[model samples]
Target: MNSDRLFTRFAIGINAAWLTLFALVPIILILIVSFLKPDPNFFVLMHFSPRSYLTLINPIYLKVFARSLLLALITAGCCLCIGYPFAFILAQLKTRFKPLLLLLVIIPFWTSSLLRSYAMVILLEAHGILNSFLLRWHIISQPLHLLYTNTAVLIGLVYCLLPFMILPLYANIEKLDLRLIEAARDLGASHLQAFGKVIIPLTLPGIISGTVLVLLPAMTLFYIPDLLGGAKSLLLGNLIQMQFLYTGNWPQGSAVSIALTVLMSLLLLLYLRLIPKAQRSQPL
Candidate 1:
């Protein structure tokens, strides 16, 4: 028995060590590289310098970072507004149909997000089906400039991240005790009051989780912004890509990447702290 226990301990230690090496070490490497000076050849130096971070103070990069944050916040808000209703509906579904409904929610994920964004490009173009239909219906005389704008970027982002927001909410809402809602009604609380006080509070943790999931990726996403925003509304992700690929500034790119990672970590910490401890411990 002692030998078996010792072997189990050794196995767990080995797995933990492997994970630290593979994941933690690379992150540390990036942090270190971010502080290093860049050589003319674009390779990072062994010695550390603050120059890369200094470059981040430039107005252009600052604006891009701010825009990225705003876009992410809006995307998270949109997802919450839309996803909550869908999740609520799914929660009320019959048991026999619940799995099918969930499968439908997950089906779009099987296709690549890039493909979906590209499809949006085709649909939202000036002469695309959406604009043509609207024109034919006399909604407007001219095709709207829907593609290659910030609005298009937001639409694409919301489309891509909707599932992430919905699934967590559905998980929580589906397990909610229907009796509690009825009990609130019995206590003379109106439907709106019950939902606002009881139902919304109960689902807060899931909402927070989904917000973090959607916000983090939305902030750093490059493809949708590049395709939909027309490369004019530059974002931090685009700046990072340009630094590495276009400008051949590896250290600067590494610095931007590190900053982004740190910002995301801070946002996630804030989000987690907003959750009440009791709700966090609740069973999903």
Candidate 2:
């Protein structure tokens, strides 16, 4: 028993050390740098200043932040709507077929996401396969302007993040007690009613998990907007990248990063608090 306890403690210590070295240290450095002043020649100076944070109050930066938040919410909501039905279908499949279906969901990971984004670019272009097919079918007189738009960026976000939304929902739905759904049906609850009242409540955890997984990354995926939305859809991720890489303002970039991190952390905490109340309120 003592040996088991000692081993567990050692494992925890090792994990803590790894997290401190990689995650905590980098976050601490970024936080510290955010408070420093940027130099004209150098990226930042040793002195402290609030200029970076103050600059965020500018309407331009506020617009970028708002755009990013809206895009993330839309992407997450789209994923949830598309994924829920697909996950439900998957969860109802036979055990023998389940692995194959899951493998199909995961097969996209073998290819680079960059490559996938580029593929979208090709498909969404004016003279692309989709347009050509539509033209051949007399769907439109000319090729439509499909690429380099917010719609294209949304397509990329949904295609990439759909799996993240589906897998969690499938896991949760697969474990659900189908008998409860049957009971609700027997008690005269209609299909939609049983789904809304019982199945949804049981899958709330998975919904939250999937939303967080998709929303956070969707907020910062600059490459997707770069490839699909072009300059017209400049997002917060692009703004931060420009600050650090192009403009050579590391302090401002760090400040933006800190702001994003704090906002997401607070949102996550709010979700955590509300989830329990939501679950408890549902009639089980």
Candidate 3:
């Protein structure tokens, strides 16, 4: 018992120390910097000012925020549509190849997402594989003009984040009580009705988890929007990156960062609130 208690205390201490150094400290620094005045020469001044936050409230930045949220929503929605069916099929599979198939899903994580975005460039360029195939098949008379567009950005976000949406859903669906679905069907419910009444209610947690995962990353993945959407499609992430790295405006960047963090925190709070409600509302 002493050994176990010692191990637990050691593990807790390590986690607490790590979080304090990495997560909590960074957040505190950012919060402090957000209230400081931006100095062109120093990057941050000790003088406290709300100018950074005032800048965030400008109409132009508000529009960017709205657009960023919209894009994130679309990415999460697309991931849900694609991931749900795929996860359901994978979970229902009885084949020994399941692990191999799941491994294929995870292989992408072994690679850099930067490389993945560049790979998307190759696929989305006018004469890339996707367009070339379409051209050969006479799908269209002209190259689809895919790269450096919102479409390309959306595709890239979905491609990169789909796995995040799938794994949780697969875990949830694998543990689903199929008999409940069958019972709904036997009670004169159609397939669609049974799905709505049984499968969705039980799988709500997975759907919410996957969506939140995709949504949060979609908001903050700066490189994808930069590489795929071009300057014309600036997002909150791109704005923050520009302020800090390109423009050397640390205060403004931290302000934007705090605003975005608040938005994301609200989503997390919603997740926490809704998850228990979903559990309680699950059909017997």
Q: Least lDDT summed over 10 consecutive residues: which range in candidate 2?
A: 275-284
Which one wins on TM-score?
3
- Across 166-281, the per-residue lDDT of candidate 2 in tens digits comes to 98888878888999999999999999999999999889888887898798889998899999988677788888888988888999999999999998898788667767754433
| Cα RMSD for candidates in order | 3.2, 3.9, 3.3
The runs of at least 3 residues in candidate 2 whose Cα sits more than 4 Å from the true structure, single-residue gaps closed, are 1-22, 274-284
lDDT value for candidate 2? 0.89
lDDT of each: 0.89, 0.89, 0.91
- lDDT of candidate 3 over 166-214, digit per residue (tens): 9989988988988998899889999999988889988999999889989
Candidate that would win on lDDT = 3
Model 1, 1-284: lDDT tens digits are 99999999999999999989998898888788889888768477788798999988998788889889899999999999999999999988878988998899999999999999899999999999899999999999989998988899999999999999999898888779999999999999999999999999888888998899899999888899899889887788888888878787788998999999889889878976998776665443
TM-score of each: 0.86, 0.87, 0.89
Cα deviation in Å at residue 146, candidate 2? 0.6
Worst 10 residues of 3 by lDDT: 275-284
Flag clash pairs in model 3: none
Which regions of candidate 3 are displaced past 4 Å? 1-18, 277-284
